[model samples]
Each structure stands twice: as structure tokens, then as C-alpha cells.
Target: MRKITHKKAAAVAMAAALSAALLAGCGSTAATTDSVAESTSTAASESTAAESTEETADESTADEAAAKNCADLIDAIYVQERTADTDARCEAAKAAWDALTDTQKEMVEGENADPEYFGRDTGDASKDDPRNEDEIGENELLVVSFGTSFNDSRVADIKGIEDALQAAYPDWSVRRAFTAQIIINHVQARDGEKIDNMQQALDRAVANGVKNLIVQPTHLMHGAEYDEMCEAVDEYKDKFESVSIAEPLLGEVGSDASVINADKEAVAAAITAEAVKTAGYDDAAAAAADGTAFVFMGHGTSHTAKVSYSQMQTTMQTLGYDNVFIGTVEGEPEDTACEAVIEKVKEAGYTKVVLRPLMVVAGDHANNDMAGSDDDSWLSQFKAAGCFDSVDTQIAGLGEIADIQQLYVDHTKAAMEALNG
Candidate 1:
């Protein structure tokens, strides 16, 4: 009985020990599983945070790329040459600009592209017509110019001529063309206005099936631009039944400096009269008597037609207007240079000088070169010379004058007569 009792006790002890071991193992297994689960959860959270950070970085990079693309596009279209892709590039530039956010637009920059390129108020473009419309009748009068980007000047000067032509030739359709592709591109990009280049304008005329075409150039003289315009018109002459290009504002550029024509005299007389009146003088003689001299600044050209400036000076001399002077920005004739003109004015003993642009439109050359505050500008140079008591500038072009417009009208009439003859 004692042996059996001891055996039962030992068996009981073994069973209890086994049960405790099993319970301890289960507790350790549960703790390990919980630790693994916690580690996995922490790793998942880290992965999610890393993904978000990468996404944010990618978004930032994309925005920067978009802004850069917009800037580059603007730079691409701000060019002088028009290609098959020019229109498309211009549209792309506008689109890219539109796509940029406000912050991105503020960051935009390029060689010729800036925030104000399309943002600046250059007057209401709608006030002026592009004259690029089609569906023309038989007779088409195409008025061509070197062109200006200034909206107000364009309307007052170039459009003034166009309107006059339209009114004068009510039987014909008047169109417009610019010789400077740069100006055309600028107007297009900045103001959403498209002025046709010479080639485009001629092609447009041919496409319109116009039988009679008269090209009236608003150029100041027969210079390089005039030559190029003639070349362009020559190509399309066969397309029209009759094609005639009228003389420019200065008429035919004579062979030499001594060759003065009626056109030069008219221009000299008209401009001087206008300047004298604007300066509160009764006439050129009165202005001269008052110790004041008028200096007319022209865009001196390298072409042989540059003699026209010299001829104008001669015409002024012939008119006995000793106080009136002629100068050129390019200093082509050497005598008409700003320095030379200043010496002439100083030697002539003029106390006051009034500067005016002799060019057709009071555009860049008139505003900046003739009258700008820059040191190299004519106004600044005249002031710096200390030769005059007071220097004043008239920011007016020849095209603004009624007499000048009449001269164009007369030239056009002559061309039209010749075309019919």
C-alpha cells in the first residue's frame, strides 16, 4: 500500500510539471507573435510615408519642368523668321503660358521672353485692323510698310494711311502687309494680331483671284526694304492681271546728292512748316529769327538711297531755311550724323534746338533713338554737347502730317494711272 501511494504521488507531480511547461510555452509563443505583428505594422507605416514623400518630390519636379517648358516656348516664338512651324509654336507658347500656375508664371524668364511680353498693355489691339481678310473683288490695293509694334503709332500713322487709301479708292479693297517679319511676329505674339509679311500678303492677293493689284509702299525712301519689297512683288506679278508698285514717300531716289525732286521739296516744306507751327513760331523764318533751330532726324540707311537725306538737306538750303538741319541716326552721309548736325547748329549760333523724326512713323527710332533718355540717343547727345540753352523734341512722324498723307495719295494716284495706262 505504501509503495502504490508513492507511485501515485510521483505520477501526479510529473503531470503537473508537464501542464506548467505547456502553459509557459504558449505564453512565450503568444508574446513572439505579438512582437512580429508590431514590427510589421511599423514597417508598413514607414513604407507609406516614404511613398508620400517621393510623390511630393515628383510633383514638385513636374511643376518646375512645366514652368521651364513654358519659358522655352516663349523664347522660341520670339524670333524674326517665320517658318512652317511658327504659327504652331506661337500657339504652343500661349498654351504653355496658360498652363502655368500663378507662381510658375512669376518665375517665367527667357532671352526675349518675360512676364510683360504678353502682359503689357500696348493699347487695345482691336482698335486697329490687321487687314488680313480674304474674299476680295477684282481690284485690290495692298499697302505695305516696314511696320511698327507700337499700337498707337500704328493706328495713327500706318492705319491712317490705310484708311485714307480705302476712302480714296472706294472701288478697290485695301489690304495691309508688313515687310518686317520680326514686327509681325511681335505683334502676333504680344497682341494676338497677325500682320502679313510681304510673301504672305502677295500670296494672299494671288489666292484672292484679284485681277488688278497696286502695291503702295509707305517706306520713307527707296532703300533696302524697298528693294526687297520689289523683289517680293516681282514674284507674284504674273498672278495678277496688272501689278504696279507706287513710289515711296520720298518718291524716286535720284542718282546723287544734288538730285532734288518735287517730293523732297514737299516733304522739306511740310515738315518744317509743321515743326515751326508746333514750336509756336509763325514759320521757319520766324523760328530762325528767334535763334532757334529745328533738327530733323532720319534713320540713315547704308543703301545708295541714303543720298536722299543729303538731298533733303539741300532742299532745305534751297528753301532758304538756314535754321533747319538734317541728321541721321546711322551717320551714313557723315554730314547728317548727330555730331555733325550739332556742330552745324552750334556754328549756326542757334541758342535753342528742337529735334524731330524725319521718318514716316514716330516709332522706335523717333521715341528711343531720337528722343530717348539714353546717353547715345540724339536728345541725350545734343544735351550733353552743351551747345544749346534748351533742347526740345517733337515725337512726331512724317506720316502724321496731312501734307505727307496727301503726298502718298498723289503717289498712289500716279501709280494707278500708270497701271491703267
Candidate 2:
């Protein structure tokens, strides 16, 4: 059925009124000439008013159609892979968005586009580098990450790692790539900052005639993202003479809960120490003695490597971080859920809780899922559990810590050494 929009309804009403006036005029045979003239004048005035109303409605309908078209354009480009038409599509979407009036822009909506699609103020995007420039030498260090749309976190965490790698390996050209193309499209659409995806970054290196390529992923574990990064590098391995991929922040995923490695131990110590110092405590034991527990939230997964989260918990326990706990947003292992962690903290008789993200960048999970005021967020869940005297949050990512950055540097160094060897 054809939907009758408001403008269509108004047009239909105007046409019906015109038909009625014509019928009344044709049936008025008893009226005098003077009365006929007066009636004709009144009819002419009504017709003019109807035409004016129709024009306004038509304009409004056109504006709405334009805004919807722009939204659809944005939705089309919000994809994981960049195609041959991606550049043209991006240009078209930006043009349409710019042409919209302030009011029309607000009306824009799509599967992934909204007013916040281009209007949200994350931070000054200019402060951070996209690092997509060309004219690179043979050796290229491609830093890959899951990526974040939060501008400040991107600068402080992701860019922080890239800068450190550039300084450590002055001979290699450091470039950036984000695994999430949705974030890539978002940053481009919102801030005009064009970040390369894995394919683009790799292709860039191949095109620039880079002989050696090193991929350093800022991921915390050998989970889905890390596996995907490895697959991407395999596709481009033949392009470079020597291609090496570094270990993720957490080195390896052990078979079961009983396995823990040096990488996990370092992360456990570093994050706990940072959290303790930030919370104004001397150490984890001191915090525990004071009836405070620190919970680290990770982005859980359904993959078999979800054991990494469990191993992290075990490593904390083995390190004697009795006050530290591990939790996941997805609750993959059933024991790492927010509710489960709360129960553990309560059982341990800790009346105070501090929550922080174990992820590289304190992006959406850290800002919204971990510390947001929503009822389902970790912060709200802990407070509503009524098991703590206070529930505080530390809105910092692991990448911001000097020790965490050094871990990536160390991993990159290992990869470089292996490539040389």
C-alpha cells in the first residue's frame, strides 16, 4: 500500500476542496451576478491559500527525503571491508551530510548513523596522527589494534603505543591500522581523520616497496582479533621479503586455567600496581586489608581462547593479589561476569570496590559498560548489589601505563630480533 505522508495528505485535501468548490459553482443557478462575483472572489482566495499550503508541504517532504538519503549513504559505507567504490561513497556521504541543514542533520538516522554519527564531540582529532602517509622506506612497522572511536583514548593509548614503537625503532617507518572498519568509517565521517584498515595498511606497505614488515597488535590476548590479524598478515606475507608478527600484550593462551606465563604475570602486576597507586593505596595487600577489592573488566569472548581471562585471574591469585578480581563483559566462562565478581568480592568481605578496564584503550566498554550510570553497567551492578561501602571507577586504559607500553615495545623487539635471526 502506498503510504500517505503528511504532505500527500495535505495535497489530497486541497484537491478535494477544489472539486467541491467547482461543484458548488456549477450548481449555483439561483444566485445573482453580483453574488456570483462575490462567490468567485472568495473561491479564488481559498484556492490561493490551498496552493500556498501545498507548496510548504512539498518543501518539507523534499527536505525529509534528502535527509533520509544522506543517512542511507552513511549506512552504505559503514562496513568492514573497503571496496573499489569506498572512496567515492565516502565522498558522497560526507557531501550529503554537509549539505543538510542543522535541523535536517538531526533527522538523519540509519542502521549505524545518527545525530551522533557526525555531531558528537569526542576530542580534537587533529591532536592525533592517522599515520597513513606514503613515501615510506623498505622497513615498515604496522601497529594494528581493535581501534576505538574515542578520540582522546585513541591518542593516549593507541597512538601512545605507535609513538613508542617509532622511537624505539628509528630505522622502521611506523604506521597505524585499525581492525575495525566501522571505527575507521566513523573517524573518517566524524573527524575527517582517515585511518587505514589492515588491508589498506598492508597494501600501503606493499605499494611503497617495503622489504620487511612487522605487525604489532595491541590486543590483550590471542583471541578472535589476534587470530584475524594473523590471517590478514598471511595474505600479505608474500609481498614482503620478511614479515614478522609480534606477540599480543598477553603472550599466549594456555590450555587450561592452571597455565600462566610471564606476559600474564607482568600485566597482572602492572595493572594492579597502577590501580593501587591511582586509588591512593600503597599496594594490593594494603587495599585488601582495608576491605577493598579491585575488579578488572575485559571484553569477553566465546572463543576457546577465552581461557586467557581465566588464566589472568589465576595469575593474579598466584601473585598473591588476593584483593584483585577478573570479570568479563560477556560472561563467557560464567565465572567472570559482573554479578559473579560481585559475589566473590562480597564473599571476601570487601566493603569497598574499584573497577578498571583490562583492555588496551578505555573505549566504549570502559566508558559505558564498565563505568556508565546505566543499570546494566558494571558500576551500577556493583552498587546495586549492596555488597560494598563504595564502588569507585578508574577510567584509564592499560595502554596509558608506562609499563604496559614497555610490554609492547618488548614484544616488538622480540619480533625484530627473530626476524634478524
The model with the greatest lDDT is 2
User: Could you tell me the lDDT of residue 336 within candidate 2?
Assistant: 97
lDDT digits (tens) for residues 168-271 of candidate 1:
88998999999888678768866789999988988888888899999999998999999999998998888889999999998988988888999999999999
Worst 10 residues of 1 by lDDT: 2-11
Cα displacement (Å) at residue 252, model 2: 1.2
Q: For candidate 1, what's the RMSD?
A: 14.3
lDDT of 2 by residue, 11-39 (tens): 56556655555567645555444454565
lDDT of 1: 0.86
Please name the candidate that would achieve the greatest TM-score relative to the true structure: 2
Poorly placed runs, candidate 2 (over 4 Å)? 1-67, 100-106
Instruction: After the best TM-score superposition of candidate 1, give how far the Cα of residue 372 lies from its true spot, in angstroms.
Output: 1.3
Go through the candidates in order and give the clash count of each.
Answer: 0, 0
For all predicted structures, in order, the TM-scores are 0.80, 0.84
Rate residue 231 of model 1 by lDDT.
92
